[model samples]
Target: MVLEPIYCPSCTSTNIVKHGKSTQGKQRYKCRNLDCSRSTFILRYSYLGYLPEVKQRISEMAINGSGIRDTARVLKISPTTVIEELKKRS
Candidate 1:
Protein backbone atom coordinates (compact mmCIF):
# COMPACT_ATOMS: atom_id res chain seq x y z
CA MET A 1 0.00 0.00 0.00
CA VAL A 2 1.11 3.52 -0.74
CA LEU A 3 1.17 6.08 2.08
CA GLU A 4 0.16 9.63 1.35
CA PRO A 5 1.69 12.56 3.19
CA ILE A 6 -0.58 14.26 5.69
CA TYR A 7 0.07 17.94 6.36
CA CYS A 8 -0.98 20.10 9.26
CA PRO A 9 -3.54 22.65 8.08
CA SER A 10 -2.10 25.34 10.33
CA CYS A 11 1.62 24.87 9.73
CA THR A 12 1.76 22.71 6.57
CA SER A 13 4.10 20.36 8.37
CA THR A 14 4.45 16.73 7.24
CA ASN A 15 5.69 15.54 10.64
CA ILE A 16 2.40 14.08 11.72
CA VAL A 17 1.34 10.82 13.34
CA LYS A 18 -1.95 9.07 13.90
CA HIS A 19 -3.28 10.16 17.27
CA GLY A 20 -6.69 8.53 17.34
CA LYS A 21 -10.19 8.80 15.98
CA SER A 22 -12.45 11.72 16.61
CA THR A 23 -15.75 11.33 18.48
CA GLN A 24 -17.41 11.27 15.06
CA GLY A 25 -15.08 8.38 14.04
CA LYS A 26 -12.89 10.37 11.67
CA GLN A 27 -9.16 9.72 11.71
CA ARG A 28 -7.31 12.32 13.81
CA TYR A 29 -3.64 13.15 13.47
CA LYS A 30 -1.10 14.80 15.74
CA CYS A 31 1.60 17.16 14.50
CA ARG A 32 5.08 16.33 15.72
CA ASN A 33 6.75 19.58 14.64
CA LEU A 34 7.73 21.56 17.73
CA ASP A 35 6.95 24.87 16.05
CA CYS A 36 3.48 23.77 15.09
CA SER A 37 0.77 25.11 17.36
CA ARG A 38 -2.02 22.73 16.30
CA SER A 39 -1.99 19.51 18.29
CA THR A 40 -4.63 17.43 16.52
CA PHE A 41 -6.68 17.60 13.35
CA ILE A 42 -9.10 15.59 11.22
CA LEU A 43 -8.21 15.22 7.52
CA ARG A 44 -11.69 14.69 6.19
CA TYR A 45 -13.93 17.20 4.51
CA SER A 46 -16.38 18.82 6.90
CA TYR A 47 -20.12 18.09 6.66
CA LEU A 48 -20.69 21.68 5.56
CA GLY A 49 -18.64 21.05 2.38
CA TYR A 50 -21.16 18.44 1.23
CA LEU A 51 -24.20 20.66 1.64
CA PRO A 52 -25.80 22.13 -1.50
CA GLU A 53 -26.09 25.51 0.20
CA VAL A 54 -22.33 25.76 0.54
CA LYS A 55 -21.81 24.78 -3.09
CA GLN A 56 -24.15 27.54 -4.14
CA ARG A 57 -22.50 29.97 -1.80
CA ILE A 58 -19.10 29.31 -3.37
CA SER A 59 -20.44 30.25 -6.78
CA GLU A 60 -22.20 33.26 -5.37
CA MET A 61 -19.03 34.42 -3.66
CA ALA A 62 -17.03 33.97 -6.84
CA ILE A 63 -19.57 35.99 -8.79
CA ASN A 64 -19.35 38.72 -6.18
CA GLY A 65 -15.54 39.06 -6.70
CA SER A 66 -14.53 37.25 -3.52
CA GLY A 67 -11.00 35.85 -3.49
CA ILE A 68 -10.23 32.15 -3.11
CA ARG A 69 -9.47 32.52 0.60
CA ASP A 70 -12.67 34.41 1.20
CA THR A 71 -14.77 31.74 -0.47
CA ALA A 72 -12.83 28.95 1.27
CA ARG A 73 -13.35 30.63 4.66
CA VAL A 74 -17.02 31.33 3.99
CA LEU A 75 -17.76 27.98 2.31
CA LYS A 76 -15.08 25.99 4.16
CA ILE A 77 -13.27 24.43 1.20
CA SER A 78 -9.65 24.39 0.13
CA PRO A 79 -8.54 27.50 -1.75
CA THR A 80 -6.83 25.49 -4.48
CA THR A 81 -10.01 23.56 -5.18
CA VAL A 82 -11.97 26.80 -5.13
CA ILE A 83 -9.63 28.29 -7.71
CA GLU A 84 -10.04 25.20 -9.87
CA GLU A 85 -13.83 25.32 -9.66
CA LEU A 86 -13.95 29.03 -10.45
CA LYS A 87 -11.61 28.45 -13.40
CA LYS A 88 -13.97 25.84 -14.78
CA ARG A 89 -16.94 28.17 -14.36
CA SER A 90 -15.15 30.99 -16.12
Candidate 2:
Protein backbone atom coordinates (compact mmCIF):
# COMPACT_ATOMS: atom_id res chain seq x y z
CA MET A 1 0.00 0.00 0.00
CA VAL A 2 1.20 3.47 -0.81
CA LEU A 3 0.77 6.27 1.72
CA GLU A 4 -0.21 9.56 0.17
CA PRO A 5 0.57 12.89 1.82
CA ILE A 6 -2.39 15.09 2.62
CA TYR A 7 -2.17 18.86 2.43
CA CYS A 8 -4.47 21.38 4.03
CA PRO A 9 -6.52 23.01 1.27
CA SER A 10 -6.54 26.41 2.97
CA CYS A 11 -2.95 26.74 4.13
CA THR A 12 -1.44 24.24 1.69
CA SER A 13 0.38 22.71 4.66
CA THR A 14 1.29 19.04 4.73
CA ASN A 15 0.69 18.87 8.48
CA ILE A 16 -2.67 17.17 8.28
CA VAL A 17 -3.96 14.28 10.36
CA LYS A 18 -7.07 12.18 10.34
CA HIS A 19 -9.74 13.70 12.52
CA GLY A 20 -12.59 11.24 12.19
CA LYS A 21 -15.27 9.98 9.83
CA SER A 22 -18.12 12.09 8.56
CA THR A 23 -21.81 11.23 8.73
CA GLN A 24 -21.52 9.70 5.26
CA GLY A 25 -18.43 7.68 6.36
CA LYS A 26 -15.92 9.82 4.48
CA GLN A 27 -12.58 10.40 6.16
CA ARG A 28 -12.27 13.87 7.67
CA TYR A 29 -8.89 15.55 8.07
CA LYS A 30 -7.66 18.23 10.43
CA CYS A 31 -4.84 20.68 9.78
CA ARG A 32 -2.15 20.85 12.42
CA ASN A 33 -1.12 24.33 11.34
CA LEU A 34 -2.05 26.72 14.14
CA ASP A 35 -2.07 29.76 11.84
CA CYS A 36 -4.36 28.14 9.26
CA SER A 37 -7.80 29.71 9.03
CA ARG A 38 -9.47 26.39 8.28
CA SER A 39 -9.14 23.66 10.89
CA THR A 40 -10.77 20.70 9.13
CA PHE A 41 -11.88 19.73 5.65
CA ILE A 42 -12.72 16.72 3.54
CA LEU A 43 -10.89 16.25 0.22
CA ARG A 44 -14.08 15.35 -1.63
CA TYR A 45 -17.55 16.50 -0.63
CA SER A 46 -20.77 14.67 -1.50
CA TYR A 47 -22.84 17.82 -1.66
CA LEU A 48 -22.65 20.39 -4.45
CA GLY A 49 -22.91 23.24 -1.94
CA TYR A 50 -19.88 21.94 -0.09
CA LEU A 51 -17.56 22.11 -3.12
CA PRO A 52 -15.09 25.00 -3.37
CA GLU A 53 -15.92 25.66 -7.05
CA VAL A 54 -19.63 25.80 -6.24
CA LYS A 55 -18.95 28.18 -3.36
CA GLN A 56 -16.98 30.45 -5.69
CA ARG A 57 -19.81 30.31 -8.21
CA ILE A 58 -22.24 31.27 -5.48
CA SER A 59 -20.34 34.48 -4.79
CA GLU A 60 -19.76 35.10 -8.47
CA MET A 61 -23.44 34.72 -9.31
CA ALA A 62 -24.39 37.12 -6.54
CA ILE A 63 -21.89 39.71 -7.75
CA ASN A 64 -23.16 39.27 -11.30
CA GLY A 65 -26.67 40.43 -10.21
CA SER A 66 -28.19 36.97 -9.84
CA GLY A 67 -30.75 36.61 -7.04
CA ILE A 68 -30.31 34.03 -4.29
CA ARG A 69 -33.03 31.83 -5.71
CA ASP A 70 -31.58 32.00 -9.23
CA THR A 71 -28.09 31.21 -7.99
CA ALA A 72 -29.35 28.27 -5.98
CA ARG A 73 -31.45 27.00 -8.88
CA VAL A 74 -28.63 27.24 -11.38
CA LEU A 75 -26.17 25.64 -8.99
CA LYS A 76 -28.66 22.94 -7.94
CA ILE A 77 -28.21 23.86 -4.31
CA SER A 78 -30.44 25.37 -1.65
CA PRO A 79 -31.24 29.06 -1.40
CA THR A 80 -30.08 28.95 2.18
CA THR A 81 -26.68 27.84 0.92
CA VAL A 82 -26.44 30.85 -1.33
CA ILE A 83 -27.62 33.15 1.44
CA GLU A 84 -25.17 31.71 3.94
CA GLU A 85 -22.30 31.93 1.45
CA LEU A 86 -23.14 35.54 0.66
CA LYS A 87 -23.25 36.29 4.38
CA LYS A 88 -19.86 34.72 4.87
CA ARG A 89 -18.39 36.61 1.90
CA SER A 90 -19.68 39.92 3.22
Candidate 3:
Protein backbone atom coordinates (compact mmCIF):
# COMPACT_ATOMS: atom_id res chain seq x y z
CA MET A 1 0.00 0.00 0.00
CA VAL A 2 1.19 3.54 -0.75
CA LEU A 3 1.01 6.15 2.00
CA GLU A 4 0.16 9.68 0.99
CA PRO A 5 1.49 12.67 2.91
CA ILE A 6 -1.31 15.05 3.72
CA TYR A 7 -0.63 18.75 4.11
CA CYS A 8 -2.73 21.62 5.40
CA PRO A 9 -4.11 23.62 2.50
CA SER A 10 -3.91 26.87 4.44
CA CYS A 11 -0.31 26.73 5.65
CA THR A 12 0.96 23.85 3.53
CA SER A 13 2.15 22.25 6.75
CA THR A 14 2.53 18.49 6.96
CA ASN A 15 1.71 18.67 10.66
CA ILE A 16 -1.83 17.51 10.49
CA VAL A 17 -4.17 14.89 11.89
CA LYS A 18 -7.42 13.18 11.00
CA HIS A 19 -10.27 15.25 12.35
CA GLY A 20 -13.39 13.38 11.20
CA LYS A 21 -15.54 12.68 8.19
CA SER A 22 -17.49 15.40 6.46
CA THR A 23 -21.25 15.16 5.99
CA GLN A 24 -20.58 13.81 2.50
CA GLY A 25 -18.43 11.01 3.99
CA LYS A 26 -15.15 12.57 2.83
CA GLN A 27 -12.14 12.32 5.13
CA ARG A 28 -11.48 15.57 7.02
CA TYR A 29 -8.09 16.74 8.26
CA LYS A 30 -7.06 19.22 10.94
CA CYS A 31 -4.03 21.49 10.69
CA ARG A 32 -1.80 21.34 13.76
CA ASN A 33 -0.01 24.61 12.95
CA LEU A 34 -0.95 27.12 15.63
CA ASP A 35 -0.51 30.02 13.23
CA CYS A 36 -2.73 28.52 10.56
CA SER A 37 -6.02 30.31 10.04
CA ARG A 38 -8.10 27.45 8.64
CA SER A 39 -8.80 24.66 11.11
CA THR A 40 -10.06 21.75 9.06
CA PHE A 41 -10.21 20.81 5.39
CA ILE A 42 -10.79 17.81 3.14
CA LEU A 43 -8.00 16.39 1.00
CA ARG A 44 -10.24 15.16 -1.79
CA TYR A 45 -13.22 17.19 -2.94
CA SER A 46 -16.08 15.38 -4.71
CA TYR A 47 -17.03 18.51 -6.65
CA LEU A 48 -14.65 19.82 -9.31
CA GLY A 49 -15.88 23.35 -8.72
CA TYR A 50 -14.64 23.33 -5.14
CA LEU A 51 -11.02 22.61 -6.03
CA PRO A 52 -8.65 25.63 -5.99
CA GLU A 53 -6.87 24.60 -9.19
CA VAL A 54 -10.17 24.37 -11.03
CA LYS A 55 -11.16 27.81 -9.78
CA GLN A 56 -7.87 29.23 -11.04
CA ARG A 57 -8.38 27.57 -14.40
CA ILE A 58 -11.84 29.06 -14.59
CA SER A 59 -10.35 32.52 -14.16
CA GLU A 60 -7.61 31.83 -16.70
CA MET A 61 -10.13 30.58 -19.23
CA ALA A 62 -12.27 33.68 -18.73
CA ILE A 63 -9.24 35.95 -19.16
CA ASN A 64 -8.41 34.12 -22.40
CA GLY A 65 -11.88 35.06 -23.79
CA SER A 66 -13.65 31.78 -23.08
CA GLY A 67 -17.41 32.15 -22.60
CA ILE A 68 -19.30 30.67 -19.65
CA ARG A 69 -20.58 27.69 -21.63
CA ASP A 70 -17.18 27.04 -23.18
CA THR A 71 -15.40 27.20 -19.84
CA ALA A 72 -17.97 24.90 -18.29
CA ARG A 73 -17.65 22.43 -21.16
CA VAL A 74 -13.84 22.42 -20.99
CA LEU A 75 -13.75 22.15 -17.21
CA LYS A 76 -16.67 19.69 -17.08
CA ILE A 77 -18.38 21.94 -14.55
CA SER A 78 -21.67 23.81 -14.59
CA PRO A 79 -21.99 27.12 -16.40
CA THR A 80 -23.35 28.56 -13.15
CA THR A 81 -20.07 27.73 -11.45
CA VAL A 82 -18.14 29.64 -14.09
CA ILE A 83 -20.49 32.60 -13.70
CA GLU A 84 -20.18 32.56 -9.93
CA GLU A 85 -16.39 32.43 -10.06
CA LEU A 86 -16.33 35.39 -12.42
CA LYS A 87 -18.70 37.29 -10.16
CA LYS A 88 -16.47 36.63 -7.19
CA ARG A 89 -13.47 37.98 -9.10
CA SER A 90 -15.32 41.18 -9.97
Candidate 4:
Protein backbone atom coordinates (compact mmCIF):
# COMPACT_ATOMS: atom_id res chain seq x y z
CA MET A 1 0.00 0.00 0.00
CA VAL A 2 1.20 3.51 -0.75
CA LEU A 3 0.93 6.23 1.88
CA GLU A 4 -0.27 9.54 0.59
CA PRO A 5 0.99 12.86 1.92
CA ILE A 6 -1.70 14.86 3.62
CA TYR A 7 -1.38 18.62 3.81
CA CYS A 8 -3.48 21.09 5.71
CA PRO A 9 -5.79 22.99 3.36
CA SER A 10 -5.51 26.21 5.38
CA CYS A 11 -1.72 26.34 5.89
CA THR A 12 -0.54 23.78 3.33
CA SER A 13 1.46 22.22 6.13
CA THR A 14 2.33 18.51 6.13
CA ASN A 15 2.30 18.49 9.91
CA ILE A 16 -1.14 16.97 10.11
CA VAL A 17 -2.66 13.97 11.84
CA LYS A 18 -5.88 12.03 11.81
CA HIS A 19 -8.44 13.66 14.07
CA GLY A 20 -11.48 11.47 13.68
CA LYS A 21 -14.14 10.30 11.28
CA SER A 22 -16.79 12.62 9.93
CA THR A 23 -20.50 11.90 10.14
CA GLN A 24 -20.34 10.31 6.71
CA GLY A 25 -17.41 8.10 7.75
CA LYS A 26 -14.83 10.20 5.90
CA GLN A 27 -11.43 10.46 7.53
CA ARG A 28 -10.99 13.86 9.19
CA TYR A 29 -7.55 15.42 9.57
CA LYS A 30 -6.28 18.02 11.99
CA CYS A 31 -3.68 20.64 11.17
CA ARG A 32 -0.82 21.03 13.62
CA ASN A 33 0.40 24.34 12.23
CA LEU A 34 0.26 26.97 14.96
CA ASP A 35 -0.47 29.81 12.56
CA CYS A 36 -3.27 28.05 10.75
CA SER A 37 -6.76 29.42 11.29
CA ARG A 38 -8.66 26.24 10.36
CA SER A 39 -8.10 23.24 12.57
CA THR A 40 -9.69 20.28 10.84
CA PHE A 41 -10.70 19.22 7.35
CA ILE A 42 -11.56 16.15 5.33
CA LEU A 43 -9.46 14.92 2.44
CA ARG A 44 -12.53 14.47 0.27
CA TYR A 45 -15.70 16.55 0.42
CA SER A 46 -19.00 14.91 -0.51
CA TYR A 47 -20.48 18.32 -1.33
CA LEU A 48 -18.98 20.94 -3.64
CA GLY A 49 -20.21 23.74 -1.40
CA TYR A 50 -18.13 22.37 1.47
CA LEU A 51 -14.96 23.34 -0.36
CA PRO A 52 -13.35 26.73 0.18
CA GLU A 53 -12.91 27.33 -3.52
CA VAL A 54 -16.55 26.52 -4.16
CA LYS A 55 -17.63 28.86 -1.36
CA GLN A 56 -15.61 31.69 -2.93
CA ARG A 57 -17.14 30.93 -6.29
CA ILE A 58 -20.58 31.05 -4.75
CA SER A 59 -19.91 34.55 -3.46
CA GLU A 60 -18.47 35.61 -6.80
CA MET A 61 -21.48 34.26 -8.64
CA ALA A 62 -23.79 36.16 -6.30
CA ILE A 63 -21.84 39.39 -6.89
CA ASN A 64 -22.14 38.76 -10.63
CA GLY A 65 -25.98 38.78 -10.27
CA SER A 66 -26.46 35.02 -10.28
CA GLY A 67 -29.55 33.77 -8.49
CA ILE A 68 -29.26 31.23 -5.68
CA ARG A 69 -30.85 28.49 -7.79
CA ASP A 70 -28.58 29.38 -10.69
CA THR A 71 -25.47 29.24 -8.55
CA ALA A 72 -26.55 26.00 -6.97
CA ARG A 73 -27.28 24.37 -10.33
CA VAL A 74 -24.05 25.69 -11.83
CA LEU A 75 -21.95 24.70 -8.88
CA LYS A 76 -23.84 21.40 -8.39
CA ILE A 77 -24.52 22.28 -4.79
CA SER A 78 -27.69 22.78 -2.79
CA PRO A 79 -29.50 26.11 -2.89
CA THR A 80 -29.45 26.14 0.92
CA THR A 81 -25.65 26.04 0.83
CA VAL A 82 -25.58 29.13 -1.36
CA ILE A 83 -28.00 30.92 0.91
CA GLU A 84 -26.03 30.01 4.03
CA GLU A 85 -22.77 31.13 2.44
CA LEU A 86 -24.29 34.45 1.40
CA LYS A 87 -25.64 34.91 4.88
CA LYS A 88 -22.20 34.37 6.33
CA ARG A 89 -20.82 37.15 4.15
CA SER A 90 -23.34 39.62 5.57
Candidate 5:
Protein backbone atom coordinates (compact mmCIF):
# COMPACT_ATOMS: atom_id res chain seq x y z
CA MET A 1 0.00 0.00 0.00
CA VAL A 2 1.24 3.47 -0.83
CA LEU A 3 1.22 5.47 2.37
CA GLU A 4 0.24 8.99 1.68
CA PRO A 5 1.11 11.61 4.26
CA ILE A 6 -1.78 13.63 5.57
CA TYR A 7 -1.19 17.16 6.76
CA CYS A 8 -3.51 19.49 8.61
CA PRO A 9 -4.77 22.10 6.17
CA SER A 10 -4.82 24.82 8.83
CA CYS A 11 -1.37 24.47 10.33
CA THR A 12 0.31 22.19 7.79
CA SER A 13 1.11 19.75 10.60
CA THR A 14 1.69 16.08 9.96
CA ASN A 15 0.12 15.17 13.34
CA ILE A 16 -3.26 14.36 11.92
CA VAL A 17 -5.84 11.82 13.04
CA LYS A 18 -9.00 10.40 11.57
CA HIS A 19 -11.76 12.42 13.14
CA GLY A 20 -14.80 10.88 11.52
CA LYS A 21 -16.78 10.92 8.32
CA SER A 22 -18.52 14.02 7.10
CA THR A 23 -22.24 14.07 6.41
CA GLN A 24 -21.51 13.18 2.80
CA GLY A 25 -19.27 10.27 3.94
CA LYS A 26 -15.97 11.94 3.17
CA GLN A 27 -13.11 10.99 5.47
CA ARG A 28 -12.60 13.82 7.92
CA TYR A 29 -9.29 14.50 9.65
CA LYS A 30 -8.38 16.43 12.77
CA CYS A 31 -5.26 18.42 13.50
CA ARG A 32 -3.44 17.54 16.70
CA ASN A 33 -1.60 20.84 16.65
CA LEU A 34 -2.75 22.83 19.68
CA ASP A 35 -2.67 26.11 17.79
CA CYS A 36 -4.96 24.99 14.95
CA SER A 37 -8.08 27.07 14.54
CA ARG A 38 -9.87 24.59 12.27
CA SER A 39 -11.57 21.68 13.96
CA THR A 40 -11.84 19.16 11.18
CA PHE A 41 -11.31 19.00 7.43
CA ILE A 42 -11.33 16.60 4.53
CA LEU A 43 -8.35 16.24 2.26
CA ARG A 44 -10.52 16.48 -0.84
CA TYR A 45 -13.91 18.10 -0.77
CA SER A 46 -16.64 16.50 -2.87
CA TYR A 47 -18.46 19.83 -3.06
CA LEU A 48 -16.88 23.19 -3.84
CA GLY A 49 -18.99 24.86 -1.17
CA TYR A 50 -17.27 22.88 1.56
CA LEU A 51 -13.92 24.57 0.99
CA PRO A 52 -12.90 27.66 2.97
CA GLU A 53 -10.86 28.93 0.03
CA VAL A 54 -13.92 28.75 -2.17
CA LYS A 55 -15.89 30.72 0.42
CA GLN A 56 -13.24 33.44 0.34
CA ARG A 57 -13.39 33.48 -3.43
CA ILE A 58 -17.13 33.93 -3.19
CA SER A 59 -16.64 37.06 -1.08
CA GLU A 60 -13.92 38.37 -3.35
CA MET A 61 -15.98 37.80 -6.50
CA ALA A 62 -18.84 39.72 -4.97
CA ILE A 63 -16.62 42.66 -4.03
CA ASN A 64 -15.05 42.62 -7.50
CA GLY A 65 -18.47 43.28 -9.11
CA SER A 66 -19.29 39.70 -10.08
CA GLY A 67 -23.00 38.92 -9.98
CA ILE A 68 -24.38 35.88 -8.16
CA ARG A 69 -24.77 33.87 -11.32
CA ASP A 70 -21.37 34.98 -12.55
CA THR A 71 -19.69 33.98 -9.30
CA ALA A 72 -21.50 30.65 -9.24
CA ARG A 73 -20.48 29.84 -12.81
CA VAL A 74 -16.89 30.98 -12.32
CA LEU A 75 -16.48 29.10 -9.05
CA LYS A 76 -18.60 26.14 -10.17
CA ILE A 77 -20.63 26.35 -6.98
CA SER A 78 -24.35 26.76 -6.41
CA PRO A 79 -26.01 30.14 -6.91
CA THR A 80 -27.59 29.65 -3.50
CA THR A 81 -24.15 29.17 -2.00
CA VAL A 82 -23.03 32.49 -3.42
CA ILE A 83 -26.14 34.23 -2.17
CA GLU A 84 -25.88 32.68 1.31
CA GLU A 85 -22.25 33.72 1.68
CA LEU A 86 -22.97 37.26 0.56
CA LYS A 87 -25.84 37.41 3.00
CA LYS A 88 -23.59 36.35 5.86
CA ARG A 89 -21.12 39.12 5.08
CA SER A 90 -23.81 41.76 5.51
Candidate 6:
Protein backbone atom coordinates (compact mmCIF):
# COMPACT_ATOMS: atom_id res chain seq x y z
CA MET A 1 0.00 0.00 0.00
CA VAL A 2 1.19 3.48 -0.72
CA LEU A 3 1.35 5.81 2.23
CA GLU A 4 -0.15 9.24 1.80
CA PRO A 5 1.87 12.19 3.06
CA ILE A 6 -0.41 14.01 5.47
CA TYR A 7 0.65 17.52 6.37
CA CYS A 8 -0.62 20.34 8.53
CA PRO A 9 -1.62 23.09 6.11
CA SER A 10 -0.88 25.70 8.75
CA CYS A 11 2.68 24.72 9.66
CA THR A 12 3.38 22.16 6.92
CA SER A 13 3.99 19.60 9.64
CA THR A 14 3.77 15.98 8.57
CA ASN A 15 3.33 14.81 12.16
CA ILE A 16 -0.30 13.85 12.06
CA VAL A 17 -2.68 11.17 13.30
CA LYS A 18 -6.03 9.94 12.14
CA HIS A 19 -8.58 12.02 13.94
CA GLY A 20 -11.68 10.28 12.66
CA LYS A 21 -14.19 10.74 9.83
CA SER A 22 -16.22 13.78 9.05
CA THR A 23 -20.01 13.64 9.00
CA GLN A 24 -19.68 13.43 5.23
CA GLY A 25 -17.42 10.37 5.62
CA LYS A 26 -14.19 12.17 4.72
CA GLN A 27 -10.95 11.12 6.39
CA ARG A 28 -9.89 13.58 9.08
CA TYR A 29 -6.40 14.11 10.47
CA LYS A 30 -5.14 15.90 13.55
CA CYS A 31 -1.85 17.81 13.48
CA ARG A 32 0.73 16.92 16.13
CA ASN A 33 2.45 20.28 15.86
CA LEU A 34 1.53 22.16 19.02
CA ASP A 35 2.54 25.44 17.45
CA CYS A 36 0.10 24.88 14.59
CA SER A 37 -2.97 27.01 14.57
CA ARG A 38 -5.18 24.47 12.85
CA SER A 39 -6.09 21.46 14.96
CA THR A 40 -7.62 19.10 12.41
CA PHE A 41 -7.80 18.97 8.65
CA ILE A 42 -9.59 16.97 5.98
CA LEU A 43 -8.01 16.20 2.66
CA ARG A 44 -10.62 17.67 0.40
CA TYR A 45 -10.89 20.40 -2.19
CA SER A 46 -12.72 22.90 0.00
CA TYR A 47 -10.13 22.45 2.72
CA LEU A 48 -7.17 22.26 0.37
CA GLY A 49 -8.09 25.58 -1.19
CA TYR A 50 -7.74 27.22 2.21
CA LEU A 51 -4.31 25.81 2.99
CA PRO A 52 -1.52 28.16 4.03
CA GLU A 53 0.48 27.34 0.92
CA VAL A 54 -2.42 28.33 -1.28
CA LYS A 55 -2.92 31.50 0.76
CA GLN A 56 0.76 32.34 0.48
CA ARG A 57 0.72 31.80 -3.24
CA ILE A 58 -2.28 34.02 -3.51
CA SER A 59 -0.45 36.78 -1.67
CA GLU A 60 2.68 36.30 -3.72
CA MET A 61 0.77 36.49 -6.99
CA ALA A 62 -1.13 39.53 -5.80
CA ILE A 63 2.02 41.29 -4.63
CA ASN A 64 3.53 40.53 -8.02
CA GLY A 65 0.66 42.59 -9.43
CA SER A 66 -1.46 39.74 -10.65
CA GLY A 67 -5.10 40.66 -11.14
CA ILE A 68 -7.78 38.71 -9.30
CA ARG A 69 -9.15 37.37 -12.58
CA ASP A 70 -5.71 36.39 -13.81
CA THR A 71 -4.81 34.71 -10.54
CA ALA A 72 -8.07 32.78 -10.51
CA ARG A 73 -7.55 31.71 -14.11
CA VAL A 74 -4.03 30.51 -13.47
CA LEU A 75 -4.85 28.95 -10.10
CA LYS A 76 -7.94 27.19 -11.57
CA ILE A 77 -10.03 28.67 -8.78
CA SER A 78 -12.77 31.30 -8.66
CA PRO A 79 -12.18 35.03 -8.76
CA THR A 80 -14.24 35.25 -5.60
CA THR A 81 -11.72 32.93 -4.03
CA VAL A 82 -8.87 35.20 -5.09
CA ILE A 83 -10.69 38.20 -3.69
CA GLU A 84 -11.38 36.45 -0.40
CA GLU A 85 -7.77 35.36 -0.06
CA LEU A 86 -6.48 38.85 -0.76
CA LYS A 87 -8.93 40.25 1.76
CA LYS A 88 -7.67 37.92 4.44
CA ARG A 89 -4.02 38.77 3.80
CA SER A 90 -4.79 42.46 3.93
* Number of the predicted model whose TM-score against the real structure is largest: 4
lDDT of 1 by residue, 56-84 (tens): 68789888899889889877678877776
Colliding pairs, model 4: none
> Once model 5 is optimally superposed onto the true structure by TM-score, how far is the C-alpha of residue 41 displaced, in angstroms?
0.3
Of 1 and 4, the candidate ahead on TM-score is 4
TM-score of each predicted structure versus truth: 0.50, 0.84, 0.78, 0.93, 0.87, 0.69
The positional error of residue 22 in candidate 3, measured at the CA in angstroms, is 1.8
**lDDT for each of the candidates?**
0.79, 0.93, 0.92, 0.93, 0.90, 0.83
- Superposition error at 79 for model 6 (Å): 0.5
lDDT of 2 by residue, 14-79 (tens): 999999999999999999999999999999998989988899999888888999999999999999
Model 6 misplaced regions, further than 4 Å? 1-15, 22-24, 44-48
Shift in Å, residue 8, candidate 6: 3.6
Position 13, candidate 4: lDDT? 99
In the range 66-85, model 3's lDDT, one tens digit per residue, is: 99999999999999999999
Runs in model 1 lying further than 4 Å from the true structure:
49-90
Q: Give me the displacement of residue 8 in model 1, in angstroms.
A: 0.9
Candidates ranked by lDDT: 4, 2, 3, 5, 6, 1
When sorted by TM-score, best at the front, the candidate numbers are: 4, 5, 2, 3, 6, 1
Model 3: ten consecutive residues of lowest lDDT: 3-12
Can you write out model 4's per-residue Cα lDDT over 1-90, one digit (the tens) per residue? 999899898889999999999999999999989999999999889877899999999989999999999999999999999999999997
Judged by whole-model lDDT over C-alpha atoms, candidate 1 comes out at 0.79
* TM-score of candidate 3 against the unseen true structure: 0.78
Worst 10 residues of 2 by lDDT: 3-12
Model 3: clashing residue pairs?
none
**What is model 4's C-alpha RMSD?**
1.0
